[model samples]
Every structure is written in C-alpha cells, then in structure tokens.
Target: MKVYILWHVHHVAVDEVGNVAHFENGEFSARENLGDDVKLLGVYSTPDRVERRISVARTLPGFRDEPDCFWSAEVEVDEDDWASGYVTE
Candidate 1:
C-alpha cells in the first residue's frame, strides 16, 4: 500500500530540505545520509493525514520557524523499493 512519510529539519538550513528529502528517498548512501538532523513526524496512510499533521506541527515550537519545511513523499510498503543497488557521490 501507498504511504506518506513526513520529515522536518531540526534547526537545519533551508538548503538542507532537499537533502533531507533525498535521504528519506534512500538516494544517499549511509555515510552521506542526513537523516540524523531531521525529525520524522510520522508515516501516514494518506496525504490528508500528513497535512493534518503539518497543521498541528506548525503550532508547535521550532516547527513554526520552518513552517513550510515539512517534506512528504508517497511510498509503497512491502514492495521492492530498489530493483538495483544505489550509488552516492
């Protein structure tokens, strides 16, 4: 099934948003991963739930600063995410 993954930067810069998304996408190797600096809000079953989470998150501290920093991507579960190996660099 398709699921929505939510992630937010922890006092990270705007330029790092894409990097975090890429990390979540499993595009970067373990050594180059930026997952540590990001806060995973939660995985949701639908985008609507993700949006609701964003709305609620925006009201919390720290999250208000990067209000739009919330990055979400739809992914399938129990599926072969990578048919082949990934490369970093």
Candidate 2:
C-alpha cells in the first residue's frame, strides 16, 4: 500500500522583529489561499481526511540564529485500510 501526502507553504518575509514580526495576521490569509487552492485541485481520494497545514519560521537578520520560531501540522492514514478511502491509480 502506498500513501500520498501533499504539503504547501507561503510566506512573506520582514526585515525586523516587532509587534508584527511573526506576521500571525498574514499567516491566516496565506493559509486560506493555500487551502482554497488545494481544495480546488480535487486530487484527494478522501476529502474528509484531506490534511492541511501551515508553518511559520524566523531567523536572525544576518547570521543563522538557530530557528527563532517554528510551526507545523501532520496527518496519518493507513494506506492499507481502504476504509480510509485511499485513492488507487
């Protein structure tokens, strides 16, 4: 059994860190756009189980400052379990 996973990310970088350095506001918008596009593709066998995720990260201005922030999401499905409605090629 084989499982298919789709992952997407969109980000707008900023120069400095401050009240909006993390851009939580833009994060929602970016997620909405990406989610809408993913839904439009209609490529998943199980729409109900279709997984979506958003991630945001930041680094120092000049040198690598060891990840300042990170976010992610994950979904697990049993490919062998047809009950999960896996698509077959």
Candidate 3:
C-alpha cells in the first residue's frame, strides 16, 4: 500500500526536525512517520474558480477523509504502462 499526505490551501504540520531520525550513541528523538521524500507535483483547482475553498484542518492516522474539489494530494503514484509510454500502431 502507498501512503501520502494531502492538504489544501494550507501546509501540514511538521516538527523542527525534517522527516528523519538518527539513533546513535544513546539519544533519539521523534522521527517523521511518513516515509520517503515527497515533492510537489502540481496544483489543481476546481473547474469553477468561484467555488468556495475548503481546507483540511487536521488529520488522524489510519483514517480516511474526503478532500474538497480544490484539495490535491502532492504525492507520486505508479503510472499505467499504457499511459506512461506504451504505443500501438
């Protein structure tokens, strides 16, 4: 299964440390649970620009939430072979 953090109109909360941890010697701190580096792919908007903007205020683990039309998930996903680079002539 793939995991991703999606938000709309606002940034997700993150701790002072980036998404990593170092367990050396005998000290450790909280590490980011979301694995892998995430990057912004693109931005999407409702077809009707005049539509109201909805924001994701909070989130819970293992819980699924509905995203507003204006909200977009900024994560990567596997591209279908045909969609990526399959050709038939």
Candidate 4:
C-alpha cells in the first residue's frame, strides 16, 4: 500500500472582478500550523471496490498528549504520482 503526507495551509486568492477567497489549502504546509506535520497513514483498498477517503495519523513530532491523533483527507490519487511533499505553482 502507498501512503503520503498532506499538510494543511492557509490560502488566499483574488480575482480580477475583485472577488477574494480565503480557505485552507491542504496541499501546503508551514511550521506555524501544527497540523502540517501530520502524515497520511495509508490508502485503503478493497477487491473490485473503490474507497472515498484516505486515513492519516500524527505519527511524528505531534504533541505527546495527543498520541492517538488521527484524521482523514478527501483526495483521489494513483500509486505512481504520490507526492512526498508540497510543490508550489
């Protein structure tokens, strides 16, 4: 099974029509955001079936008090192009 690390980041965008959008950009990570260090644990698989979400865990460097920290991020990816880190466009 293939796994990855997805970091969360704050993002902002402005359009030519003066419309602005601000939201969490999951593909980015920064030291200021604690959750950026979280790791995507693995990709769940079922024979002849497709899954809707991926599992993640705060494996390393996360707060000790929250040792069992876990969550899921919605994404669609193939094993070939699983990115290890974020790439800015």
Task: Identify the leading candidate in terms of TM-score.
Answer: 1
For each candidate, the alpha-carbon lDDT, in order, equals: 0.72, 0.32, 0.32, 0.35
> Per-residue CA lDDT of candidate 2, range 1-89, in tens?
22334333233433255222333645632234323121221233443333331112123331122232233333355533356676667
TM-score of 3: 0.16
Which tens-of-lDDT digit does each residue in 13-88 have in candidate 4? Answer: 4435644322236422233343334443444444212122222222334423343333334444554444577777
Per model, state how many residue pairs clash.
0, 0, 0, 0
TM-score, predicted candidate 4 vs. hidden true structure: 0.24
lDDT of the structure predicted as candidate 4: 0.35
**Model 2 clashing residue pairs (backbone):** none
TM-score of each: 0.66, 0.21, 0.16, 0.24
What pairs collide in candidate 4?
A: none
- Candidate 1 regions off by >4 Å? 11-36, 87-89
Residue 45 displacement in candidate 1 (angstroms): 0.9
Ranking by TM-score: 1, 4, 2, 3
Best by lDDT: 1
- Candidate 2's clash total is 0
